[model samples]
Target: METSSRFEAAIKKLYTAFHNNTLNPECCKQCAVGNILDNTDSWKYLSDDHGNLSLNYVGKVHQTLGRKFNGYSPLELLQIEATFLKACGFQIPLNHTNKRPENPTDNDILFNGLSATISLLCEIDNIPNVMDYQKLFKYKKTTFDYIVH
Candidate 1:
């Protein structure tokens, strides 16, 4: 499948899983990207030794993507994935946890969706270099600080 379509399918799968409360360890094993994200490598890349993304984090992730995959830079791949995940109601940190705050913001339908989407996107071996689409999710922030959008 093409990158866009593959990404869309992955986002849909995540959206479904997110609402269904299926983004747990059970599903991660079956999910290509989930397995990767659950491990140390993915976290270490993003977290690195600093324990958080640095000023050059985007560049670092872009470089990592280039090394791991044959096509598309990090921006090209994440732009769509990020947008779709936000639209599906995923907050970055909330996605990683099984529990959430009492009230759900526009964000934090949970990161389950974003995490799944990212994980699946990583599974794609070679994304096309062409930048066919560019979408950004402009979500307003509240007290919650861990949001990726």
Candidate 2:
């Protein structure tokens, strides 16, 4: 799959923000994941009105799709990001029993969630949507995958 320069720049900006101490690592993770989910139909079940991931979506994804949480079960998506924060050596508020104390363990394990999200977006025939997850997120838009403009 190709990559999008805009999306790559955005994620790079986020990384810079985290390094500059403007945006914390947890928020960086959420924004990264949220932006990904937002650009897809999974936004319906994964985000709230403000486009942030909600506990409701968390419960739904877990219950409906069996997408297991790496850290906390009964928690907000932000909490999951926070878990990643803790694993990354940041202090979390009201910490719980972390499933993986060393989180972002595999470069955010993004494929795990994105794979499931893609499954939900596809039809029973396993055909991918117009907004191919990787291509879209990577900002690699072609006429075949999606409209250029």
Give lDDT per model, in order.
Answer: 0.41, 0.38
Q: Which stretches of candidate 2 lie over 4 Å from their true place?
A: 25-95, 99-149
Model 2 lDDT per residue over 1-149, tens place: 34344334434544554444343233333433333333223323443422233546555656576453322132334443433344444344323443323443344443343333334323222454433557655665557566688
Report the error of model 1 at residue 49, Å.
8.8
The lDDT of model 1 is 0.41
Best by lDDT: 1
Off by over 4 Å in 1: 1-3, 24-44, 49-65, 68-100, 103-108, 111-149
Model 2 worst lDDT run, 10 consecutive residues: 68-77
Error of 2 at 124 (Å): 21
Top candidate, metric TM-score: 1
C-alpha positional error of residue 31 in candidate 2 after TM-score superposition, expressed in Å: 5.9
Clashing pairs in 1: 33-119, 94-111, 95-111, 95-112
